[model samples]
Target: MEIVNFTPVPALIGGALIGLSAAFLLWSQGRIAGISGIVGGLTKPVRGDLAWRAVFLIGLVLGGVLYRVLGFGVGVDHIQPVVSPTLLVLAGLLVGVGATIGAGCTSGHGICGLARRSPRSLVATLSFMGSGLVTVFVVRQLMGVGA
Candidate 1:
């Protein structure tokens, strides 16, 4: 697939959206905007909570669709990570496991946690980022694990 360059504008906008969503979820529903929890809730959800969770997720997907429908005005087509397919999959699995063990993903722990001044989530966010940095240092610098 073709890759696009990374620009600060899109990243900042996306981050703002995430922060907004997390804030809205907490204010409106008293819930954390952790993606995994939302997906997990689908398996066996409490009566009233299910609808909102589904709505939140649907809105997320629909936002992308709306962006595309609006002609994707941005110059960047897509941002692609520099990693091999196997390593990418491995990284994704490790991130999923880490998020599960930490009880939340980056958006949940970093943005939401910081907003709420949650010490545990803050620590989890730092640890998660540190691990990622160390992993990249080891794989790319030491082991030469990818191209």
Candidate 2:
């Protein structure tokens, strides 16, 4: 339960930006900013629907790069991996499967769906948070992997 870096101001700003971007996407394009859906759409290209998805994904990557270049958040030197590449890859695959099964990722369910007062989103978000908490407990407390 120890916090390594607790920069509330930067965290707040970053969260606000995410919210704003999600809101803008919903307002402007009548779309939810669900990254998994966006990426999934890219995999099975459709007519007239490619541009915004590509741009959104690109913006995500470029936003991180811009943040790093501007030195606004945690630096590269401060980032230390707590897991092996293989484990990371496996975890990513699990997440992808979960997103597919659940119908949307956190951005879509937690942010956009919750904003719209959707019951399914509430359940999905709760499940996501509960699973995350259990995973952290198992990894840090039981396995002593990250500790």
Candidate 3:
């Protein structure tokens, strides 16, 4: 399969959409569009609060599904990650653990928190970015673990 050529248009569009969504959520409901917080609220949901959270999570999943179904990105092909299954599972587990320990996922901290001028989220976002950079350096540059 061919690696897709890079372009800025789609990224800019996506970012604008995300910002608009966040702003709309804040304006309409006075709620931050943080995925982790929304999803987490589902676990011990209060009456009348569960519906929106479930809808948000479902919309998140359906976005990707819709994208693929409509022939965007990798089109209709089943696009698998380049990493091994074991590595993928481990990475997912690590992200979940980090989100739990850090009290928010990247979307919560990076997008919503930064927008709200949160110092803790700033720190968490920076640390996560740094960790990601180091991991990429070690995995790709040091270990030569890629296609």
Candidate 4:
């Protein structure tokens, strides 16, 4: 098996930026920077509350656009989706269900919740990471995908 190169600097910078964003949201707006919570709130809007969520989601989309425009992750393998679109959609639905069941998404549990030392977040984050590892193992080793 070919080992993947790990770029610590970029990963560290990205993680730091995410933490900063979460911290800024909490510090400034007294809110958790959880995508599912934000977007779910959008589905059932309340007066005087939908604007920030819309702005946050829009910023997320624009960030991806800016990243693509800057040609980040251009030629490196493993960046592109390996699964079929149907499977991708199914996986997304499952993730949505999982996030709902778990009461938060990865950002909520992994970053903000952990920073606040929440026990629920600890369990949620561990389960999230463990499931991810299992999924990759099944896809790559058991299924011989992208091998």
Evaluated with TM-score, which candidate comes out highest?
Answer: 2
Which lDDT tens digits does candidate 3 get at residues 1-147?
456877689889988888888898899989889787887688767889999889888888898888877778565476669799999999988987788778787778899899899999999999999999999989998999983
lDDT, candidate 2, 1-22, per-residue tens: 5787689997898889999999
Per-prediction backbone clash count: 0, 0, 0, 0
The reply for model 2, stretches above 4 Å from the true place, is 1-4
lDDT tens digits, residues 37-141, model 1? 786677667787688778878998898878878898363365577787887898788877777778887778788777889999889889989987998789888
Candidate 3 residue 43 Cα shift, in angstroms, is 3.5
How many clashes (backbone atoms < 3 Å, residues ≥3 apart in a chain or on different chains) does model 1 have? Answer: 0
lDDT of 1: 0.80
**lDDT per residue (tens digit) for residues 1-147 in model 4:** 676887899999989989999999999999999888888788778989999999999999887788778886474434778888988998999988898889789899889899999999999999999999998899889999777
**Index of the highest-lDDT prediction:** 2
Residue 144, model 3: lDDT of: 94
State in Å the error of residue 74, model 2.
Answer: 6.5
Which regions in candidate 1 have their CA more than 4 angstroms from the true location? 1-6, 43-48, 73-85
Looking at model 2, which ten-residue stretch has the lowest summed lDDT? 72-81
Q: CA lDDT, every prediction?
A: 0.80, 0.90, 0.86, 0.89
